[model samples]
Target: MPFLRENSGKFSPEKIGALIMVLFPLALLLIRALNGSFTPPTPFGAPPGLGAGPGLGAGPGLGGVDPALGARPLVEVIRFIGDWAIRLLLITLAVTPARRLFNWPKLLIARRTLGLGAALLVGIHFTFYLIDIGSLGMAAREIVLRIYLTIGFVALVIFAAMASTSWDGAVRRLGGERWKHLHALVYPATALGILHFFMQQKLDVTEPTLMAGLFVWLMGWRVMQRYGRGTGLANMLALAVAAGVLTALIEAGWYAVATGVDPTRVLAANLAFDYKISPAWWVAGSGAAVALASEIVLRLRPLPVRRAARA
Candidate 1:
């Protein structure tokens, strides 16, 4: 009901919009379960079946998800659900920046719904993992023994905590400041989510790199705001540069530490225009576009008449 009702107990446009946002992905899952034509995109040149390994298969083990139906590859279906969880989580983080940039106070209503929806999807993602293994005890042991799984589990726990406390009564009990500080764990939770994603990749890491870059941009903006550098054009552009460089470093760093690749070569490959544009450039371009849009919005804002009396 919170997804459909505004804070004032009225059914407002923002609430309706948030409900739509929440349900759309579930519908996508249903479609994927019934018809596999709408499979989520894979990273880079990887085939759809690239990572279809163990614990993911077209069998009767899907805990009612019925990944066995349709052409939905079990691994891809699960990955699709998990990716949407991350997407929703990222969108939740983007809401505040977007509201501030566009001067849309109504946008705040969607944040709770978005965050909780993301939590729900993550719950489902984990549920599918359980189904894949077909045993809770085994899954528990795996989650305990596997570092990547542990990272994802911790992130899920954070999301669950935030979701449980999203109500007004909980906020009253915890106090607004304390509640906010508790929810601040989302940043690190998301970092863990990204790490889990990268570590699980058997092939291309293009999507994980891009998602991490976007997270970097969001955090950069938050840091700028904290330092009183307002999200002005110059500051935003500078943040974009920093985020891009950091993104490249992140990609190169992962390759260096996780694989036998040369970090310097990977980092330098980002500047190779002759090949594909790296995820770093995409993140920078996305950030620069947002900065330009904010600049335009500021300039186009209505000017106050000198003779106008104070309200």
Candidate 2:
């Protein structure tokens, strides 16, 4: 990746990674579209907003439609976009942590690329949401009035602001300190975006839970690293363990309140291997892998002093 190589040209690894981020999601959408996933609930060329308004029961709002081209497709498409948007957002967040933990300073080169890619995904996600609802007028009203939509809209606005200011010209015009402060809005933007995802789901929160756990780990690692607790195998492992436990607790608490279920059962599920791996284990394993890879890289790279002496 150009991000990894200092002397690389236009097709840098970082640029490639960012391109993949965009193309992969676009490919999925294309596949779904070709498979008729974007087919409307009404006829193929139905006029805009005939009977497909929010309350008409043919869109994402309430009423259901034909099985072949039902509202489910719209939901699936919106969700597909939303999921990728959140993943890219997390990937953008991970650049700093990965750069610091792995001693790969060039990783910062990809941060803007990933961030802009995420903003694009969020933009597409919102556009699909509007298309799914079938009416710009009703969609605008719903976005303004609906709690979940409002939250998502706010997150998208934040993304738009950040993306707009991502260029060097914007930085110079805004001043470095002001730009940094303005861009810090990403923290809340990501949080609200994830919460919007969680709230929109009526069931099967495994993915959202996993996303939330990862967000915690990425942010937590940054905080720990900022405090001079330098990256090491032991520290990374500890943080992973703590993050895993926190994930379990968060899932348990969510279920406890949302369904009045036994929190113990949720906690116990994390230990049982028979069932599919839980989010906590996934988070822990990912963190551990990063730690292991960092250690391997550190050990393999020759010391700066030794390299200079040899030269």
List of clashing residue pairs for candidate 1: none
User: What is candidate 2's TM-score against the reference?
Assistant: 0.84
Q: Estimate TM-scores for all models.
A: 0.85, 0.84
lDDT of 2: 0.77
TM-score of 1: 0.85
Reference-based lDDT, residue 76, model 1: 61
Candidate 2 residues 54-158, lDDT tens each?
A: 222343453454544545666667767787899999998988877755556666888888898899999988887777778888888887777778899999999
lDDT of all predictions: 0.78, 0.77
| Candidate 1: tens digits of C-alpha lDDT, residues 89-184 | 888899988877665668888888888888999998888777777888877877787787789899989988988998889989999999989999
* Residue 135 CA displacement from its true place in model 1, Å: 0.8
| Per-residue lDDT of 135 in model 1 | 85
